[model samples]
Target: MCGIVGLYLKKPELEDQLGQLFSPMLIGMSERGPDSAGIALYGDPVADGRLKLTLQHPDMDYDWDGVKKALETQSGAAVSVDACDNHRTFDVQGDEETLSQWAEANLPGVTIMSLGQRIVILKEMGTPQEIVDRFDLTNVKGGHAVGHTRMATESAVTTAGSHPFSTGQDLCLVHNGSLSNHNRLREVIERRSSIRFQTENDTEVAAGYLTWKLREGMDLDSALEAALEDLDGFYTFAIGTADGFAALRDPIACKPAVLAETDDWVAMASEFRSLAHLPGVENAKVWEPEPAKIYTWGRAA
Candidate 1:
């Protein structure tokens, strides 16, 4: 089992409190998943023609300053660094290909969590509260965010096995429950799509599947609908994208999921307690998400 929480702010006024509001929800679900935890936050977009790269080094004392200078020199792009614990986010002004080449040649032993315009994902092998504290998550400000606490069922308890796996640009997923046919599906995906997965976790495969579909021009809603048919499992997923937040449940609906929405925000979690502290939640429209259905909210919608 795992714990998943997501908050999508409809009111621009609450953007500044995105992390403040999300922190407790993640902590509330600590008992559900104590193995590892992570969060995907959608902050303001970087300047056009530039991309953001979120990286983490296992070494706590890694020299970020030297690495930053090296990246700037290698990519020939201005880079700004934001450090949190062992994690650093670099806003790099260059094309994706150039940055990829530079990273391959220069930044060995670093894990690239996510690369995109509006999303930053930070996760590690630690308790939910530890992750929150390590990243100063309580002070983070964003438009929307998705978080997860994982009790490992299939993979080893390591930073790489953590939840909120990212496959597409600005897209990530946090999942509860297991995918029974994941291994087979992983083979199928590897044979057909250009996408490559870096983890053995089923959640990562699910994220990659969605990335493949999105690359094929399917929108989030359609990609989820396809997932219901193609994937076999009892799972609840909270997916975050550059401009949208979505939740999906398998047809069995065996996993727990509750959604609460008000004029100001839309929130979902594995249980009601995770969302108990949101402002105006007492008056929110709360319900259990239907099985095999996709629920979505976006800035554009």
Candidate 2:
């Protein structure tokens, strides 16, 4: 009921083409999901002691420069703002938590998409091509990226309800299929973890679950291993982080998933057609990810 695509470049020379390649893959899946689309890009890290925050505003005339000045004055550090469409990426030289607090008090009607050292997530209620064109995704450069086009089976079509949910810093998840026990799991997570749920969407719960488990000292692979046991329902998840990307499927593996890996990159999609046009794809190793197995790769791993 959704489309998922992820790309991790193994060749450093292809880093600059990350977005250029990924944009088409995402667009290819538009028929699967036309309600909403999103992408999480893991680009170069911000300068040490700095972080990036992506904020979206509904108002076209929003004053980005004024907001940046206010943030800089309040945080007592330099803040740079880059505007693209309705979203603004702020490179802030201060504590992420402190800046979030300042925004909550000062910026009215602004939605914070993500804050991290290496990731920027942009998603909205539109077709995949529309969303990408609005954000100039083809020009974006990153080490790795994951994207989703949603059909809206679980939640209403709203910007906040879009996929690629981010519950932890630099972490995002795009899911296909529904979770059968999400309500129960959501209740359990809320009672047991400090991480709070921001939306009723089950995908957000999945992202929160990963964040909670990682905070509990579980490595990414181990956390995904645990997810297969605790979480129910059919799903194909493509998760992104600061350094890498990972994919997981339910034990039953009802949802579709295809992976193509070449010496230069690793790519995954809900279907193989999305990957057919990638460079060296014909020579790449192709297969369906096994049930209950986790596939992960990145610069760090």
Candidate 3:
């Protein structure tokens, strides 16, 4: 089982509260996934320049050493790396062009999937405080976004197996449940594509499939609809992107994803308890999405 949560706020004041609210909420759902946790924030358009990247390793700080030099040299932005017990943290101050360009030219062998002034993604393979301390996450600001605590079922526990897997330049996905036909889908995608598969995990495979179809220029809506049709399994997914957010369960909507929505914000989790913070969010009016149904939340503007 995995935990997935998201918040889309219409009110700027409500949005300001998201970063503070997010870590705590994610902390609440830690039981759903313990292998790793992540958060992707999309601040309102027209904000200051800050894109932070955090990395953790047992004996070395590869994520910091490598990504920092790349961003500074390639993008002409100033970036710095800090050290936590097991991870290295850093922040880069630049525009979308600087961050996106550097990540692309430098962050090879990894998914530099999402990049934009509208989004900031931070995650780690431990508790929320671990993530915050190692990455200096709280300093990286944005209007709204997502974070995850992962449970590595079919994959090894590492940053590679974390959630909110970014697909498009502005879209990242977090999933629960298993895709029974992952082997076949992986084979099909590998044989007929330029996309590369990096890990043995089903989540990465899922991201690859989505990325492949999207590269063909298919919109996320149609690509996801096709993914639902072509891929068979018992799964629930939360996809976060710059333009908006989406979540869906399988044909039966078997895996649960309960949600709370107000004119100012939208939040969902594996259960109602995860969204209990909403003002009038009682035991009632909180429900899961219908089978095969896709629910989306996007930029308020």
TM agreement with the true structure for every prediction = 0.95, 0.95, 0.79
Write model 3 residue lDDT over 205-284, tens digit each, in one string: 88888888987888878888998888787788878777557887888777778877776667778876667765555633
| Ranking of all candidate structures by their lDDT, best first | 1, 2, 3
Q: Residue-wise lDDT of candidate 1 within 1-301, one digit each (tens)?
A: 8999999988788889998999999999999999899999999999998888888889998988888898788768778988878889998887655665577567788877888898899998888898888888999998999999999998889898897888656889899999989999999999998677778888888988998898889878888889998888879999998887889999889999999999988899999999999988889999999998888888421
Give the clash total for candidate 1. 0
Residue 42 local lDDT, model 3: 76
* Candidate 1 vs 3: which has more TM-score: 1
Between prediction 1 and prediction 3, which has the larger lDDT? 1
**Model 2 over residues 1-301: C-alpha lDDT tens digits?**
9999999998878989988999999999999999999999898889987989889888889888898888788768888877888889999887667877777678888988888898888999899999989889999998899999999987789998897887566788899989878888999998997767767888888888988898898878888888888888889999887788889888899999999999999999999989999998989999999988988887432
Clashes in model 2: which pairs? none
